[model samples]
Structure formats: C-alpha cells, structure tokens
Target: MELLIKWLSIALSSSVKFFAGPLLGKVYNLPWWQTAICSFLGMMVAVILFSTVARAFFHKYMKGLFNRNERRITPNKRRMVRIWNKFGISGIAFLTPILLTPIGGSIVAISFGTHPMKIIGYMAVSAAFWAIVASIGIYFIPFNFH
Candidate 1:
C-alpha cells in the first residue's frame, strides 16, 4: 500500500535528517495526525533501538577505541558539549529532532551518557511537536499542490 510505504519512508527519514518525515508527509498530503504520529513513532523506535544497541556495543568494545580521542575534542564536539552542559538531557532531547536527525541525536546523547529511555521519551515528544509544526507550516504556506 502507498500509505505503508509512505509511513516507512517517513520513519526511515528520521534517522537521516530532521524534518524529512514531516516534509514527506506534506508532499504526500497526509493528515496532520498521521504525519505527527508517524514521525514520532519513527523517531522513537529509531532512538530506542539505536541507543540501546549502540550503548551495549560501546560498553563492550568501542569504549577503548573512543578513548584514543579523549585528549582532542573537535570543534563541533566542543560546541555540542557546551550545549549539553547548558541545556542538559531534556533540552537536548526536545531539540534534537530539529537540530539533528534521530540517529545523530541518539549518538550525541549516548556520547554524553544519557539514559536510553529518557532519550526516547524526549525524542518522541520532539518528533510529535515538530511534525505538527511542519504540517501546519506547510498547510498554511499558500502553495497548493492539489
């Protein structure tokens, strides 16, 4: 079904870029609720699975590899750390979906040692909120594709 494929596309999109899912929804002319829910669901699932698995893998193997870079922080990483320090987990989660893809956000959260459940909760809420914003913005843009 087209809807199923569309939903899957939106879900997968969250892993790559912010606003991708919502943009897909607008392009597909999906209802606002469906757009929001699908986007949230996609981000939630991606974050939960990615964070948990990544955490486990990191703890088991990647920890030592990352320790090599502990002495030198990239500028981007320094900025991210500053943001993390200023806003903490909640703020990061709420803003991640807009600032970064679900996967990128999860990676950042994991790097900062945030709990996976909290990341999922915050990202889900963010995804839903952003989806609503995107839908509304697109709807009111005066550009009718119909």
Candidate 2:
C-alpha cells in the first residue's frame, strides 16, 4: 500500500507537471526505472486525455467561452506560430516535457489541427525520452535535499 501510494504520487505529479516527477523520485529515493516508467505513463495519460476527450468536450460545451471573434494577435501567439512553422510537431514534442505541460502541449497540437494519433505518437516518444533523462539525472546526481 505504501509503495502504491508512492507510485501514484509520482504519476500524479508528472501528470500535472513533468519536472515534479523526477524531483519527487529523487526525494523519495525511488529507483530510476520506476521514476521513468511512472512519469512517462503519467504524461502520456494527460496527452491522451487532453488530445481526445477533453478537446471534444471543450469544443462542444465550452465554445461560447472562447469567443473566436475576440481573438487578437499577441506576441506569444506569434512566437508560437513561428515555432510551429519552423519546428512543426517534432519541435513541439521536444519542448513538451521541457517547456510545456503534457496537457498544454496537446492543446497546442490540437489547435493546430494535427491528427490525434500523431499528437499521441510524438508525445509518447517525448515523454519516454524526457522521463528517462530526468530520472537518470536526478537519481545519479548527488543533491543536498536538505
């Protein structure tokens, strides 16, 4: 039960914030493999949920909240467009764990009209890669957690 709690905690943390999973694993002294798998699964779950179900729900029920007529150009949106033009899905996926949360990244991809399966594929690969990197870095590096 205690171990299950720890695993769930790691998963929950990564589901919301990717970096938190590695930090929590270090604090808990969990093995690198456990950290990697849990974090990857957590992020993938978020990506899937946001890319599919939440997206449809929001488009259907929350359409009035967005107000497309009120849309205006912003520097951030311009920059995102530039990035999208330059890097495409690969760039977005690479930046997902590093710069964007899984849900946020999925939303960005979905807004751009990318296929859902493509979003899932790229996100899965990115999550797996980053999970491995973060878990290894956190567990191997000695940090003064005091």
Candidate 3:
C-alpha cells in the first residue's frame, strides 16, 4: 500500500511537472527503471488526455473564446510560432518534457492544429526518453549540495 502510494505520487506529480518524477523517485528510493516507467506513463496520460478529450471539449465549449481574428499575438506566442516553424512537432515534443508541463505542451500542439495521433506519438517518445534520462541522472548521480 505504501509502495503503491509512492509510485502514484511520483506519477501524479510527473503528470503536472515532468521534472518532479525524478525528484520524487529519488525521495521515495524507487528503482531507476520503475521511476522511468512511472514518469513516462504519467506524462503520457496528460498528453493523451489533453490531446484528445480536452481538445474535443475545447472545440465544443470554448471555441468561441479563441477567435483567431481577435486574438492578440503576444511575444510568447511569437516564440512558440518561431519554434514551430523551425522544428515542428519534434521540437515541441523535445521541449515538452524539459520545459513545458504535459498539459501545456499538449495545448500548444493542439492550438497549432497538430493531429492527435502525432501529438501522442511525439510526446510518448519524448516522455520515455526524458524519463529514462532523468531517472538515471537522479538515481546514479550523487549531488552534494552544501
């Protein structure tokens, strides 16, 4: 029961913030492989939920809230567009685990009209890769903060 709780905590935190997975895993002393899988699953859950269900919900209920013609182009949006133009979905996926929350990344992808499957695929790959990388880093590397 305690073990399940720890894993669930890691997964829940990872869903909101990818970096928290590794940190929580380290705190809980879980195996690196388990940490990696949990982290990947957590982020993927958010990505899938937002990319599919949330997108549908937005289109149905909040479509009128985002009138493209009336929307102002903020600097943040400009930067996102620049990145999208330069690297497309791959770039977004690459940055998602490191920079953006899973929900945030999914919303960005959906806003740019990325297909749901494509969002899932790219996010899955990114989450798996980063989960492994972060788990290894947190588990194996000893950081002595003074």
On lDDT, the candidate that comes out on top is 3
- Weakest lDDT window of 10 consecutive positions for candidate 1: 137-146
- Residue-wise C-alpha lDDT for candidate 1, range 16-111, written one tens digit per residue: 775777778878888867777777777888788878998888778877877785587799778788889899877778778767777788888987
Q: Which is superior by TM-score, 2 or 3?
A: 3
Worst 10-residue lDDT window, candidate 3: 137-146
Across residues 1-146, which tens digit of lDDT does each residue of candidate 2 receive?
A: 98888888999899899989988988888899998999998998899999898778767886676566887889867877888999998888889888789988888887777888999999898999999999999888888897
lDDT of each: 0.78, 0.87, 0.91
lDDT score of residue 53 within candidate 2: 89
Q: Deviation in angstroms for 78 in model 1?
A: 1.0
Error of 3 at 50 (Å): 0.7
TM-score of 3: 0.92
The lowest-lDDT stretch of 10 consecutive residues in candidate 2 is: 58-67
What number of clashing residue pairs does each candidate have, in the order they appear?
0, 0, 0
Off by over 4 Å in 1: 144-146
Model 3 misplaced regions, further than 4 Å = 144-146
Model 2 bad stretches (over 4 Å): 61-71
* Candidate that scores best on TM-score: 3
